[model samples]
Target: MTPVPEPLPRRVTVHLVTGGPAGPRLFGARVLFGQDPADVARRLGGLSEEAPLIALDVITEIASTPGRVPTPLHVDRVVFATPEAVDAWPAVLPPHGMEPMLAELVAEEPAPAVDRPRLRRMASYGIVTDPTGRIMLSLIADGFPGAGTWHLPGGGVDPGEDVRSALRREVWEETGQQGVVGRLITVSSHHRVPLTGHEVYAVWVFSHVHVAHPGPARVLEENGSTADCAWFTPDQLGGVRLSATTRRGLEHLVGPA
Candidate 1:
């Protein structure tokens, strides 16, 4: 029998890049263990902008920069976006992006208690509801986390995939339903040791998706994490065994389920 291969460990680095007439400059970078990097950056810089967090796919942008500060750290990806882009999600920020205190924001963040290999992932989920106000949910397939429990229809965002596009694809694959993506509801994170025995950190972005006309729901993906799908009235949800995140999202979007 062939042994199952473990997933490669993952890490995230949040870099404070400044923008202005002087051009984009690498301000500082920090390795985040389990906390959400965007939220940390927001609190540290006191940014009031409501733009999306952008992911940096290239490493040379940080590794081969001039005047870069050295830290005892390693990372897998970087998030580079300015908070001052007014009407557009520009590739960089404006002159007034970060506060002057950003240089001192390079302190290392706390890691998870377990010292196993770390994997950080961002996923997009939807609180899918039809015009009739019934919520749609999917059942977890056997062998995955929360097996047999009902869960929100979504999964990890693929590499180079757009967040909203990923959510729409996941909704259709897991529930065979289409929804118009709406305002972002909330961002939630959870850390755990999974069956693979890896230290997994999941950052979930939840949004409100509305379906105009509905149809019978079913799982469309082959051998996917979702085993089944169905629509539930608000009263009926109380008896369903919902995944922790699903329950949390439900309580946040609507009333307690």
Candidate 2:
């Protein structure tokens, strides 16, 4: 049996040439290196032989991976084009009329930045009821920005960690309650960019829990992210300051409590 040959890898040359008074402008040419690397290099915007250029290695789209953000520069103007659109290599690139092309490409077809703002979050909370049928909740002392806001007895889900496991740990640490997390109560999320200036793309998950408790909720750890913890009845939930998550938790587990 004959073995199939792998598809040829696309190699590319990028040109960084001075655009008149503007700083450096980038352009690219790509083809299978085995077919015509030198030709592709020559066609990259027909950059002048004297113009300074930066050589880079660009693999085929299949081989491309997520990368770091490119530094933005203050340029007089930038002229750039994708290699795919240039079907036939021209003998000479037009020197004039770059402004219109630059406007169309840069403004209309803005390149997706590698470090664009992306939302990411994950949390787990357990629901525990006291002998009076009151729900266990935690008060944020220092961590959650809202000092006295009520929150579910749970916290963030660490990577490579099970959802139930994270909930169990958070419940113990924040409320001094021991429990086995039960079926999921609800899954909800809200989007907001943190001021910390980090970009992370993620999905959020929530679950309901059954606690094997000896008594009411109390802060297990001293001076933890949670300031204080307690069990509150449904009638009292409305009067107390509550986080959105806490409100949602109440709405899902029991109606409007």
Candidate 3:
């Protein structure tokens, strides 16, 4: 009788899909083992290219079950697969690494993972009133919320930066006016669907301001999105297009504009 050749050592790996936050994904895959170690590696590598964000490593299919590893006939060296190398033929093998996803996989009292919404906070627009009681509004040339429309002269407040300082810098940059930042008039927020289709919540702080008779309003930010800056009374705003954000801001700052 002729001797039979033993099959090369290779195992099927499955991400083991389960209910709950189980791993990064349902973590299941169909793997084929070839007689050649290199061919087996090639098949595993091919499976990895589709998911760019995840990390896949090769391991002996000993206990290839949901978040479980069984005893292995043999283990391969270099199991961790890199995304870029996955496309190459017979790519380098990486060492086996832990699947932290397993820890995330909850078998009891399962709760599905949820992605929470994000938030952006900024504000410091000043209601710099003249004797006429009109506030300083700057016309935006481009960018979000409003373009070719007027809004209060201020911008986003940097983290750990004084709100008053940020307001002053914004006022100076957009309208080139120096003023004393006064009491916070109101804090207002508006929610809208941004271009990314994600909900965005913006909160701003509007403050009462006092300033002397200032020089001509100059746009200090060179080639900035602000096309023009000036003081305008509510009556003058009759024809101007007000951004929804500005409308909400105005509703909170003074009265309906």
Candidate 4:
């Protein structure tokens, strides 16, 4: 069977008109075309033939107010793009004179909902802290059969298990460190492995606790889900290779400074 092609990224643009007695007028427009130069030329040719040419005089008249001689009106260049690209266009064009005003007009649209059906699974992770509020992390055993990235100690909440209870149990089972799970920090949604399957709902808790003692952290069972754990400072957090969802969860707890 032939492999399917991935969707192409879209390009978009906005046009702005300034001058005349009244002030300025802004127009939002878009053109859908592929990235190839030939494709772009073809689309441009089609547009030139289909759309009537915009007259400078008409643009000036529209910009001018009653009894006021219209100042030299400037019609900015035309731009093109798909709907998504158009929505994300920058407020201002070139010439650097109209950036502030034009940028205000550029707006971001919300992402469309995911279409795939996924099982709703909840997992809780505790940002467990020591006496000085340093975060705890762990490394999985070499024999463990899972993604071998260093991660916070936690696990999936079984059926009938409360989120906090699950966190405590998982932490103790994985790291042998006992601590109380505290307030809820944030919840994030992420697609499961292979990106073509179900989604995982992860809840992160900012728990306040003191570590009783430091012990060797290891993966007792050879589970194929998690492999290692270790403590990470905020600076070290960035260097650790974590799943996208896990990174998002941690970022939620430690917001932009």
Candidate 5:
């Protein structure tokens, strides 16, 4: 059997049109590796300056074409939201301008791994709610940071995988439950030095999720990062220790629970 090559990282060039007579518009064009917004726009039959560049949403997929794209007349994703409501969208918004980031994204050379061993990871976690209003959490297995502590059911997004898909996969693997992915609630980033001997930066995307009917919580993956899983009521949460990301997500999404 032939070995499969790794899927290249994808770029979503997002332009936020906050002001104009036509009102607000959010335009996103999905571009492949080494493709810029101008190239994508030209291929789509539109102008690259349709709106102001605001964010670059990166996604990895298992497989994709070289440069297949959305039509110019109809973009891949479009939305209209007030500035305050932008966070509700599924796209990740950066804190600063996207120009510098965009430049680095299309760089030809990969960052060296031998120096200090730096890694950046993206993950999707959910604040899952059952019909009974209970929240689900999973215990981190031993040898991991915050072992014995509980956190939301999620892990790192795999290479070539989108965040939403990763969330569902991880949720099922860690908790053995099915969830309907809802709106994005928050995005957070944390940098840790010397974490398992690497300087790691993690970007966490949290969303509200609903589990219409749930079975007994259990870890379903063999030797996975999760040791156990369970649901908890808000009142029962005070005594349980939570990972920093989980605590922050819960506080932002549903208040200190």
Candidate 6:
């Protein structure tokens, strides 16, 4: 039997961001040195000769921080890429040894800076019900901006509120009909809007047994978010316009039955 070869240590180049919000920001490339340090340096040095200075900075950062550095000591906006040539790294690197050289290299060259916006988020759901209490489908209003087509009678989950409560509130507000939540159906996501997007998780639910009122459905509030809520049978959906996500939600709620 042949002896199994030891797995070559994987190499990764990581970008480190250092500096305070008010002070100058520095970007450094760090090469994750594996078994050998000297070989790592040689490979990085060769790459730096051909690649841009920014690439060199990233390599230097990785070489400086080996098994011990905590992630937060670095600032935000670090980029990491797996090295394609793992075998080229040196087999022997000194422990706790490369920081001084890395510091000097980073001092000589600094990285460019930019501001990134914080992501804003909100959660909603699709509530559906079927006829004869078997399947459920939520009513969706058409022509809402960015919604494009189909939508469920659900909206933003409030702070500290559970998903069930949010779904009930959204259903009542959109459909003006009370319903009891049944069981969780499915969860889905939609990213039609560029910066602001919606993540919807749906639950199959039955109509509240107590509430009994019905009339011609029309836009009750017209708050610019929705046009009107109208229930549809699975067969009725054929001609009516619906969003792909909403359509998918309907399928989950009522599949073949």
Q: Candidate 3 — worst ten consecutive residues by lDDT sum?
A: 71-80
Q: Against the hidden true structure, what lDDT does model 2 obtain? A: 0.51
- With candidate 6 superimposed using the best TM-score fit, by how many Å does residue 249's alpha carbon deviate from the native? 1.1
Residues 110-145 of candidate 4: C-alpha lDDT, one tens digit per residue? 333766543433456767776655677655445542
Candidate 5 error regions (>4 Å): 1-7, 10-17, 20-22, 25-104, 108-114
Pick the winner on lDDT between candidates 2 and 4. Answer: 2
lDDT of each residue in 48-104, candidate 3, tens digit only: 324332123223222222435532222222222333433331232223433322222
Query: Which digits, one per residue and each the tens of the lDDT, describe model 6 over residues 1-257?
Result: 99995432222223322223453222224332121222233343444423322111112122232336522122111121124322222222235433333333332223214232222223445544534432223334344543545466666544344456766777666656666666444332333223344422221221122223443444444555666666566676666566554565666545522
Give the total clashing residue pairs for model 4. Answer: 15
> What is the Cα-based TM-score of model 5?
0.67
Q: Name the weakest run of 10 consecutive residues (lDDT summed) in model 6.
A: 52-61
In model 6, state the lDDT of residue 216.
Answer: 42
Q: Which runs in model 2 stand beyond 4 Å of their true positions?
A: 1-119, 194-202
RMSD of 1: 8.1
* lDDT for position 81 in model 5: 34
Clashes of 5: 4
lDDT (Cα) of model 5: 0.63
lDDT of 2 by residue, 211-250 (tens): 5454556688776779888877778887889887777677
Candidate number that wins on lDDT, 2 or 3: 3
Sort the candidates on lDDT, descending order. 1, 5, 3, 2, 4, 6
Error of 4 at 111 (Å): 23
- lDDT, candidate 1, 190-213, per-residue tens: 777666667878777677889897
Point out where model 4 deviates above 4 Å: 1-117, 139-146, 191-212, 222-224
Off by over 4 Å in 1: 1-31, 37-42, 45-115, 193-196
Give lDDT tens digits, candidate 5, residues 125-218: 9898999999999999998888999999887877656777889999999998999988767554566766357777666667777999898898
Model 6 reaches what TM-score against the true structure?
0.41
